[model samples]
Target: MKKLVTLVLFLFILTSTNVVAFANSTPKIPVLLYHVVTQNPSGTYQFSLTDFKNDMAYLKKNGYTPLSLNQYYNILNGTVTAPSRPVLLTFDDSTSDFYTNVYPVLKQYNFKATQFAVTDWLDTNGHLTRAQLQMLSANGIDIANHTIKHQPLTSDWNTQYSAINNANIKLKSITNNAANSVAYPYGNYNSTTMSVLKNLGCQGGFTVSGGLSSSNSNKYELPRIIMANGDSVSVFARKLTTGY
Candidate 1:
């Protein structure tokens, strides 16, 4: 009887392990964050063009498909079929570097990506022009609001609320596409900020909290891993593996 009970316990352990493995076998999604896709400008947020290209190449070679935030939300919400290898490529700040450096590589792979732009900063020195944004939309890229002045949404109720609302209005007015997503400037946010975003009809928001997102996570305060200088191809590859 003792031997029979021990065998039964061993079988139970094996069955449990198989069950856990089966659950984990489901594909995990990754949402990668990027800012200032341009030449390294010393203290500024930037990614070297070579690294950007290599990362894109790695994604392509590894059979990764970049999805827009809306598509990703739909997958999480069970409204659409999720890709076998779903990954979100997001660029913030709408820099001219994106047009000059990043666009070609994205185009080469025919991968869709999300870009958040501060409406008030368009057409300034290093930022992207309105025409460039329109071109990006026409090329099938997803554009979202990054606030009008790039202020942290935690400042105050009125200003913070209006910043998000006004930016979305202007972004759509320019690109004729619904700007439904927001990225917290400097990854700053509070409870009130999240409330404002919900009232403004924002489908989702991004934070620089550094981790993988899931269906159980907050859609409005999603965390993302930043990609920047010193992140080599191997590091990038590892990030994809960890889903960060």
Candidate 2:
């Protein structure tokens, strides 16, 4: 009887240790956000070309793997395992500068990225054109939805649903790939926003919150770290390692 009790305690300890090990091995990835990448920095979200390139070089040299929005979700869904040093590089607004500036550098690094595009902004005022979107989609960049007009989804249900669904339709018409995920405009979203997104069959959502994304994170409020024009390579490195 004494030996049997000892064996039972040993088995319990072993089980607990295995559970702890599995929890510790879970990956915590960082999603970095960007807006405009250009030589001429103007807005708060505008990032300089040199810094942007440096950031990419740092990520590449440090063996960081950039994943698309879909791949990120795959990791969370348990169908796929996360890679070593996984990072989700997300560019918002899908400005013309992304075509003129960011796309070339991303190609040079051979990195995959997600572009959160405002459907209404496309083909107007400095945003990416339909041809540009198609080209990017064909390449490694995954175009996801921001909204129809970059509007915040704090409004009524009808407005939120239309803004998201219409943008999804528009993106499909251009790239033949509807959005798998979405980023809430200005990080504004309520329960209504989530309902609209779920009804549209969205897999996940992103927000402007700064934190590391874990497998257990909320599906509709995954976090992202915003990049600014003045963020240096060192700052970028710190944010990447510590997850803001």
Candidate 3:
């Protein structure tokens, strides 16, 4: 009986050690993608402000740390260590809803986020203006490239290159910060897209593909989970704990 008890204790210790090792080896970072935040959402991509606030509250209460895309890149490159339960919150499209609906909630939590902006859309009606983008950058928000016209990168090489370069230039002019990351327009890209981004010195690229990002993820094709309209608090919890 004494020997049996000793064997069980040894097995428990071994199992616990292996579990810890596995967890350390595989660090899953969930990058959440959001399009627009509004009280009355119009499409599947738009999320209500109420739901967005709830999601933020859950993340804050759950000890999840929000990291900007630049910080995420540093972590991936081993230049920085991540906090426990680190999450990357990314908002695509520089819509006015972000200025009106999202920034206030994020500010309340003192959290940081990345915003991908289309250069041509700025200063237009119902879109984020240059002044707003500059202010967002000053307040810990990273302004990234989302192409000039939000066109799919499956087009010709010149078209793809021009779109990315023009957007980067305009974004830098407005924010005085390098636009080093990109989120593919419509979550769409082709074989030439990555090469174009690389040549332009883009450090990170995001896709709409749903999964947990890791250090081993492709720099130009990093996956992100979409947070859409009507996602409850429970659904948000599951997306963080379990990859889509």
Provide C-alpha RMSD values for all models, in order: 8.4, 5.4, 9.2
Q: Model 1 — TM-score against the truth?
A: 0.86
TM-score of each: 0.86, 0.89, 0.89
Model 3 residue 219 CA deviation (Å) reads 0.4
Backbone clashes for every candidate come to 0, 0, 0
Q: How accurate locally, in lDDT, is each candidate? A: 0.84, 0.89, 0.90
lDDT of 2 by residue, 83-140 (tens): 8799999999988999989999999999999999998888898989999999999998
1 or 2: which has the higher lDDT? 2
> Sorted by lDDT, highest first, which candidate order results?
3, 2, 1
Best by lDDT: 3
| lDDT of each residue in 1-244, candidate 1, tens digit only | 9999999999999987865554344345678988876656444457777788889988888888899777888766655666767889999998888888888889989999988999999999999999999999989799998999999877778988889999999999889988998999999989888888889888888998877776656988787778867689998987876855
The per-residue C-alpha lDDT of model 1 at residue 51 equals 81
Model 1 worst lDDT run, 10 consecutive residues = 19-28
Residue lDDT tens for model 3, 125-198: 99999999999999999999999999988988999999999999999999999999989998999879999998
* N/CA/C clash count, model 2: 0
